[model samples]
Target: MSGAPERRTRGRTSPSRLRALDAYLLHCERPLLERQDGPWGEAAFLDVGFGEHPWTTLESARRFRALNPSLRVIGVEADPGRASAAASHEEERTHFRQGGFGWAREAGQPVRLIRAMNILRQYRAEEAGAAHEELGQALLPGGLLVEGSTDGPGGITVAYLLRRGAEGLAREALLFHTDFHQGFAPRLFRDWLPVDWRRRMVPGSALHAFFAAWTAAWAEARAQGADSPADSFHEGARRLSQAWPGVSAEPWLWENGYLRWQPPTEVPRPQGL
Candidate 1:
């Protein structure tokens, strides 16, 4: 494990806890998932901290393989016992391993994607930068690293989509999604944001400004007769996109409870990061 500091986290996870995230990726990252040239031809999708069971990992494998049947999937758990127990679910195209942030680099695996959901919640906010760098070290150029948190039933999720490029891992965008299970409100995602962004949503911060704009848009939409949760969300997102520089205006995203905010510049990093 490279003597890296170990992570001690709860192994509480349920089946399909990350299905929304998988679907988002399948829709937006189709090219990355389906490409089979050069390094991508042998790259693997690494699911880190897949918890007590490999259900989410297995679920993603099925969804992603629909695009590329030859894809390889590996589930990584920090707990040795949990890792061993998950081995029973392995197949010719899937595997389980005991490791942490640096696993892919140490194992000499080329990676096309890395999903580290709900893994860094227990870590101090200041530690996220190093963790991100470590996790992206093995990604092939143009590959992606999705790290974030989702609500228990997977009704809400906020993730960082970092893409590896010639310059390194770029903080490409902040992806927000919700099923409106708790009704629609911009603040519903505050608690589910990635660890680095969770503490940065205070006054004078870019994230705070972003949320403020969203709140305003929501209120405006409500005033315009968008009454239901779904209606408010869809209309608010449409207004936010018009007011915001880089918010996506795609009808599919708004209608389906998703908002992808990719600023013209990279997602602003918290001071320490």
Candidate 2:
């Protein structure tokens, strides 16, 4: 964690705002959630910048505990008052801490997973990488950092699934999800991309090209009779996977409005970020 202070960001949040993300992790990141050997035995699941309330953090604690009963859960807030107020909900295995990205390291807590959803919207895009590094410093090897943004009600989300490795946090994959509450389109994710990528989708860039291809695939799917949003997404994703390397063909993902693109190498960082 850097010694520099973290700027305070908006704390708006609603109940169940991140439920879809929780379900996605429980289903797709089972190995990470279930592992309990070595450092994992004492590792905690950290929810960074948990907003004005700890509802999401509490919900995730219940959901993840089903897989690892002894798992410790910590909800961290940069705001001292919010963090202190959250303490009322703490139990034997849950805690509310007032700190920034360096909270875990400062407290000597080993982390298995970190969720920093919707916390970077106010920061400069160039600062996201450093933030990621600071947040990942306390993770045990193989731990995961899920950093991203979701819509107001959380029907849509896009996150970076970074994995801690021998080298450091590897930009492993990009996860896109939409429940179709407002209907679906490849463009729907542009506004919800992780902070670093939200403004990097210009022409000539990989991110732009990726979205262009997806939009084309979606149109083609619709032209071929994919009617509903879900159907269009599934068909378009299937086509995109065929043309794009590393697009996951996993049936469950398409069926559930999730798309995981894990390139053979690191997911490309849009230049100039």
Candidate 3:
């Protein structure tokens, strides 16, 4: 239960960020929509650490509601002032609450999805696993947990999709979003790796080698006069799949600006820390 206290910051929200996540959001929503007749008749989305603006939560609620009117979108904040400020922006099916990841249990109903962006950054790396376990307990069966952070004008972001499994929650995929023009490099994603894995980016590590290959491919594509970032990313993914055939089974499309791969069965822990 111990974690960083909520440190309030400027509320900068963009429609583009929400738009970029549209595809993944839809993918996460499908299952809940299909199971509408279950115990929790209506689907709920909890946007944890939603700042004062809560624009992302508001827009997300509006978009998802368009598909299923019964869906409820709640913006959650740990800072009381920000939560109160967000109240003014609430609409009919969308509301704001004052709490953190712990709010999940208090909901008294199953939650289908929870988005915790930039929330874990404040906590030490050792605290991430505990926070993840806590969040998993708040989900309905087969619920999805999307958590990550972004930087650089909002174009570069990395997110991990953790799906609720029979045992607990397991990381389903690792996603990356980057400005193709800037080219994909290992360093660009270093800051966004989950707290636990951030320090494990070294030789012999799956992620370190993965990014190395991506960077090499990007360089080769650019040298051959690839016109856009998408072109470079496609070439990079192709090279990556060629080197690691397992990648072929996952969604590594260039258009999504994400290279999603199944998480390793056992995540390698950082050594010599």
TM-score of 2: 0.97
Per-candidate Cα lDDT values, in order, are: 0.91, 0.91, 0.70
For residue 134, what is the lDDT in candidate 3? 73
Worst 10 residues of 2 by lDDT: 1-10
Candidate 1 per-residue C-alpha lDDT over 116-162 given as tens digits, one digit per residue, 9 for 90 to 100: 99988878788887888899999999999999999899999999999
Please give each candidate's TM-score: 0.97, 0.97, 0.86
Candidate 2 positional error at 142, Å: 0.7
By TM-score: ranked, best first: 2, 1, 3
Show where candidate 1 strays beyond 4 Å: 1-4
Q: RMSD to the native, candidate 1?
A: 1.3
User: What's model 1's overall lDDT?
Assistant: 0.91
lDDT tens readout by residue for model 2, 16-71? 98988898999988888888888888899999999999999999999999999998
Instruction: Report the lDDT tens digits of candidate 3 across residue range 123-180.
Output: 7677776677777677888888888777635577777778888988887777776765
